[model samples]
Target chain A: MYPRAFDYLVPRTREEALEVLAERGSEVKVLAGGQSLIPMMKLRFASPTTLVDINRLPGLDAIDAVNGHVRIQALVRHNDIIRSDVVRAENHLMTSTAPWVADPLVRNRGTVCGSVAHHDPEGDWASVMLALGAEVVAESRDGGTRVIPIEDFLVDMFTTALEPTELLTEIRVPRYERGGGNYQKLERKVGDYATVGVATHLELDEAGVITKAGIALTSVYVRNLKVTEAEALLVGRAPSAELFGEAAAIAAAACDPTSDIRGSAEYKRNIVRVFTERSLAESASIAQGS
Target chain B: MEINVTVNGTPHTADVEPRMLLVDFIRSTIGLTGTHIGCDTTSCGVCTVLVDGTPMKTCTMFAVQADGRSLTTVEGLKRNGELHPIQAAFKEAHGLQCGFCTPAMMLVGSALIEENPDPSEEEVRWAISGNLCRCTGYMNIVKAIQLAAQNSTTGGTAE
Candidate 1:
């Protein structure tokens, strides 16, 4: 189905796109790769008066290493991030999660920032970004750019801390000291959304005791669920299969899995418990190897 | 808007609506019926085409956005009335039945072989998973990709 008639603006610069966004505010929608927005528009869920095409916007599709951490532009495509040498080397979790996003064709059009801004609870990037302690950079018409931690950025399901007049500029991931991470998602088919997804990061010391851990679960609630209790359980403890199982149980208990045709709430919870344990154990092994 | 793009090696300029999709522009404006539009959403890769070198879903892209870019549709695969290796392989392998999804399947398969000449059966399946064929001839399609990869001699011998 064709989307409703709208004025299209192909802005060559971020300044131009922001200017249009500032003036039009909620009446205007930013088009990154049109992966999410177009589908929504066609379905009449979103009927904007103007479309600000920012594909040509400068400095929005780059990946760089700065401040000892990897920085990615919000407009970077999924395939681009997956293929970036610096991102793959420095952030293996993000690298691993990128390929599982959708099929290759979807990755060619989906943008990292767009996904974050769209803020779908079932989206793979949100939980992975949350697990990595990623930060978001947003610019408003008031000439101020704010940095928001991923924790605070995701306010709830389908919502963010971003103002209507603000446009996301980039996402900043902090430099981790010594951590190996893994992302595992359970899907029914090739392009279907996750039924239960887990992203885990484990940092161990020479003694193989967990120094730090981050666990984020998605597609189980209104937003990406952070298993804080699970992280606390593993901290300062030896990364063991039994410990991982206990933490996974805690996380599974924390999730409020919704019922869908993909699976029942009970089934989703079961997978969450099992995958969480497996992912944590796998991440621990990789951490030890590293 | 008047947009300029090179389709199948020929540069053409057309006056069209800003909202016109790339697939519509190619089929309606350029009169190339080789590419089919099965699903407008990016889900079905029936409208797949090479933007620069990577395969993209034409239904999700606007004609205006493709201005000044090099586009290679399925129509460009043939030379001097000779079928591309991928098309020939599909014919030999009986990869297509209904033919609704053939153009897109061929485009994605050809592009996959070009990138990875010796793609495994799993890799080939993953590569064309975006393109759906209701006929359920996926096994033969996979075999056709294997044949094309072997013929390319770029190190892809389907396992």
Candidate 2:
């Protein structure tokens, strides 16, 4: 399949990128990694008049710890995240989730920020970022930048809060105190998208009481489902099989899964419930230092 | 747009359309057809090539995006008319039957061995997970990669 013809612009600096966006914002698509956009273009689902290739832009690919947040530049590939010692040390969930994405070859070119910006309902990054309470940094042509919470940034399926002139530059995930986190996805095959995916983060006090909890789901709804009700159920509670089961049920009820080829709605909901229980159990065990 | 890329130790500069995919550029423009296009979508890695020594699906990337970069295709895996160890192992172990996915499988296997010289059987499987094969059932493919890992003293690269 061949994508429609378009003008390609390679910006050497961040300011140049923003300037191009400012001028051709509506017609131009910012190509970062091109893992998702190129495919969409080939499928003719997207046909931008111009593609602002930002791959040459310097200083936008660093993974750094800034002011208690692990800041991943927009160009940080999934393979980079998978290999980054900083990511593994600060957020183990990202490490676990990175491999579940397409595959090793695709991961070498797919960017974490690109995945977040694409905002696919079945993408794992949005749910992972939601579970980590991550923030997205967007810069516009006016030399102004804004940080958006993951919840606000991911508005709906294939949609985000970013304006046409805005370029998503970085993603910042808070470096919380060491905690236990896990991402579980039920895909039909190795490289398939998730039928139902769950990401869990748990913080525990020394006495083994849950101090904080994040439970997010993917592929069961139009957007990343953060089950705050289930999260609340886990807080102030000790790790137990019964508690995990209860929270899983709450999370499953919150999902709006649709019947499709992957499975029926009821079956998907059951998978969600079961995966939630299993992931929470694993996360809780890791949290309890077992 | 004109792109200057080095493929298989040879530098080539050509004028190409912005939407021209790297796979098309390699096959049509540069006249190297070893990299097969199984699925234009990124799902199938039969179009996999080494961009800057990392395996990438060429069909999913634009030729303009690969400007001023280095690429390695399956055609580059041989030296002095002799097959590279990975290729030899694949032939000896019968890694491929239909041969549509062999080039990508060999390139991906080369990349895997280059990164981890002693990759286990499970690691080999994971490395080639993206490249799909309808024939051979992947048993011989895995064995070929393991055989290459054992036979090659240095990394699986032909210079």
Instruction: Give me the candidate number with maximum TM-score.
Output: 2
lDDT tens digits by residue: candidate 1, A267-286: 99999999899899888877
Candidate by candidate, in order, the iRMS in Å equals: 1.3, 0.9
Candidate 1 CAPRI level: medium
Shift of residue B106 alpha carbon in model 2, Å: 0.3
Model 1 / residue B138 / CA error / Å = 1.0
Q: Would you estimate the TM-scores of all the predictions? A: 0.95, 0.97
List clashing residue pairs in candidate 2: none
Q: Candidate 1 — which pairs collide?
A: B117-B156, B118-B156
User: Against the true structure, whose lDDT is highest?
Assistant: 2
lDDT of 1 by residue, B1-159 (tens): 888999999999999787788889999999999889986867778888889978888888878889889998888998788788888888888889999899888889888988898999999998998888989889999999889888778543232
